[model samples]
Target: MAILTLGLATAGSSGAHPDHGGGREDFPGEGVADGSYKQHDGDEGHLPAVSRNVTLVGKAAVTNPSGAGNTGRVADVTAFGDYAYLTAFREPTCENTGVHVMDISDPAHPTEVTSAFIPTSDGSYAGEGIQVEHIDDSPFFHGDLLIHQNETCPGETPPGANSGGISLWDVTDPRSPKPLAMHVGDFTNTAGGLDPAPNQTHSMRMWTNVFDKKTYVALVDDEEATDVDILDITDPRNPVLVNDGLDLGAVFGVDQAAPTNLTSVFSHDMMITKVGRRYVMNMNYWDGGYVMLDVTDPRPGKVSLIAESDYAALDEERSARGHEISPEGNAHQSELSPNRKFLIGTDEDFSPFRIVAKIDSGPHAGTEYTATPATDSKQIGEGTTISGAVTFVGDACAPLPAGTGTALVERGTCTFQAKLDAIIAAGYTAGIVFQNHRDDCLSQVSMAAAGPIPFVFANRFAGLRLLGVPGVTEATACTMTTPATGGESTTVKSVFDGWGYVRLFATDVPTKPGKAGSIRQIDTYAVSESQDPAYAGGFGDLSVHEVAMDPENNNTAYLSYYAAGLRVVKYGKNGIQEVGAFIDEGGNNFWGVEVWKDETGEQYVLASDRDHGLYVFHIDC
Candidate 1:
């Protein structure tokens, strides 16, 4: 069967020149915490000359203001005029919540607009698919509407079990937005369902151009076993499906670079350009970089692959030793420049550097390199430390170490054998590992079966290590703690479990200095750590997240890093500088970012924090 093809263009500044961290101004030190706390024992500081200019901006409490609590985890950001749209998984107070609207007319002072309920979720398992837009017309008729993807219908039970769908809101009134309508029922149920039956929409957009007098919105129904659906939402209250399945060329033919056995052209995220005359798509986890499809014929528009940048083309090892979640390489979030000259993508891996290919030209042509250092500079040879923890899952800890002794293990590496063997080889004590991030930690059942030495798992940040757990390995354990804390910091209660234990220390044996994977120095804290493939354990607080900038004004950028809340900066030829930042002293993570200008000539910044729920900020400080 012929498949639809879409041309993918590269956008943004080409070339992976050294990130000098330019375009930043001195940050007002008042009301801000010490920026020199050392993110990772030996990581860089909040300087104004880093490759990605991200300064810590004023941070507002997303969980509790009076109390120092948080709802960790930020996702994406959408800006419309002077407002910012934030989507978080949940909040400490709201808990597994929804979207938050923020006002950022003043970048320094951000205020909350409003928050919509998304209901509780099993961590990242259940939640909402959110996207906001300011009224624009090009290929389709248009009106004011805010559309978000729902994991399930509004009133459904077990949102986790229910499939995803779409929800429309009337944001004509910025202050008070109302739910305009929700497409539900048997047909809506099977849009893009996980079950063979399909049930939710993955990606959606409304286009307005020379084509129609009314606004036309198209949704990629994940539940619909066939094609994407084009809907005529000329009337906000009344929407009709123009075409459910737009025919495209076969996915195999479209995927020219098949480094691994992954499919191509699977409907993922799409961007409307050329005034809705063309739509570019990134088929889920595939080889075809970007596809350009002509939606002129909404019913049967032709889709073709125009340009592609393949990761496998550069690193074939990505396919063989790649992790399961992103085995085919993450063709995930991709953006194109306004001039439609460049296309940039984000790889979903913890590699020291991010993947930036020159979709346009030059030495960076089909090239991808690490955006940042994978490991700390000093820790480059003595081996990497695995102590900075966020969320640990697994069994409760049992007393040991002094009496029988306990072993500390990290979440990565599925089998507990490596840790146990290392412990047994060293000859001593009980055993325990920080639980995996994504799964509940399983106890070392077989080891305990033989009257094991208090085999247990510590699932708390405090319970993760044993700073001074005495034994033959006492020196190693003591090395992990900060000498300033007098190396006497005891374990606080675990976030998941009620119990706690001292932390442990086990650095990878030091390799040659400056070597790719060597530990060089020792520090009091870790800004970034290592990750484990098994149980997806290594994904916690080991890597540096992403930061984005405004093309017109590079100095204006947002940093949504883990633990590092929302950092607003003004970058330029000077150097990377910090303006202000908002951080949840408690646990909270910041992700995706987008800045928009509304019709009212106002600027809004939207940020998606992981799990903490959506955050709305007004940047008028």
Candidate 2:
């Protein structure tokens, strides 16, 4: 069994990136605190248990029989005709729990038609993003084709195992889905530093272009070394690699040189849409932001750059800190309006902080300083100013010495929470400032909990300056401020202040024959005021996850607003407006949502909750 650890960063810049720490770690026994699982307590625990015009039609507790040590969290869901396809991560035991096929013909009660698992010599399982495509009058095979990415955790791969890519299956027999082929790709460790190149496939999207008379599948390479891989699946059984390394930088007309921060340049997720005669692919490049490429000519294995968007402009304030560039913002996912006039992008920064400090007295009095907030520190208030003596904890990365004094600013190891606690125990009431251990700029720190007092982090130069000051060593005093409240406030501020919002852009030329021709910035849309702090667990309080367009209405869009539940927005000449929303009473942590029309022509919204099972809602609008 694996013990879930809440301290481990689970939130990705976007939903597509693997869990921050990389796959699930194994530990003994059931219900152990392994730091892998997130505590769904408080607002994240349960939904409100109420409903509006939206009614929960059908649900399947696939993850039930919990305590198996595996992540019961359902990854993604896709529907076709009378069935729905669901994929789940491997169990804690590293057992394969592949795909779950549901008979959703009756929306109110979904029944599992069949469950499939991938066999691995090492016991690791398969599952991540799953999609189904229908091929009619094809030269290869016919009926429904199921394709799912085969993703294993960072260290979970067996010896001599090349275990990551897309798995193809024939689901014509829903009760007996047969595995057709497994296209194994490259593998690269995601634990930071370079280990290898060409990472494994994380998520994929496949479609048959009627106009081009061919089928294509695009998969994210999951590592920083590679961006995306395009495959030709015209012969479902024999998938061929079209391009192993489709460089987004080259396609976007940017420098092909490797970025200093490799994580920022990798491809995390992608979606393909047909706008008029052009087949466009919208890629969510981690730090690169939103990138659009023209894939109209896939046969040539070449993609044309359309328009690329970056959030560097938003980093001006952060760059001013220590005169160092702030890390790239996470551009996790991107979706377009039904009319393709507006592009909705999501930035996924799990834990973010803004540093604010000022010297209250001494020669440095009135001198302002910028320090980042520790993810584990309690939120500081604007009205509170903590003053104390300047002290050093210990050597960088070493344990603090016993008998440390109180109310003193201690500089020591970069990120040892235990050392920080030791200083607090010695009666440090004012605050603590940690010095960066390496030459790189001081980045944000993720802690398990907020300590007794405020904890601010300083860059190397700032730390050296403080150490040199006589007053600072004797009786240094400083004021610290953060968002209003503590826990809830930190959660809200981290997202709102960070990069996880929507960015809309226009192309240099018209995507449609009669649409506008020039490129320009469109208006940005955030959650409505109703989601303010006053309303606990409101839509505006959470980060935006995935967005889906209403097929029938070019102006309508549906969003899975993580903890905010489901929201419906309308965008057009009048601008974007929130037309409707439904926050389940049970407390919703919605991950992905899709809008589909049934055989009877009635439109419904299918939403996947990280905690709850599948939810089917009637789109009244």
Name the candidate that leads on TM-score.
Answer: 2
Weakest 10 consecutive residues, lDDT, candidate 2? 484-493
Task: Please report, in order, the local distance difference test score of every candidate based on alpha carbons.
Answer: 0.37, 0.54
Predicted candidate 2 versus true structure: per-residue lDDT over 1-621, tens digit per residue: 321111111122221253333212122111111113231454544335445546666676554333563233555677777777666554344444466667777887877663443233243344446788788856888888988876554344334444557778888777677878764444434443433323456678887776767888888775433357777888888777677557776555432222222223567778898877777888877666677777766644456767676554323323322223333356667777666776766665433332334444445544434344444566544344444445544432343444432223334333335545666666554344433333222322223335756665443334434444433321222322111211100111122133234445554534542232332445455453322323333222355667777777767777776656787777765456677778765466566787766788777888776555577888666
Give the C-alpha lDDT of model 2.
0.54
Q: Which candidate has the highest lDDT of all?
A: 2
Report lDDT (Cα) of residue 554, candidate 2: 69
Off by over 4 Å in 2: 1-53, 65-72, 90-97, 114-128, 136-138, 154-159, 187-198, 210-212, 250-265, 299-301, 310-329, 349-499, 503-519, 529-541
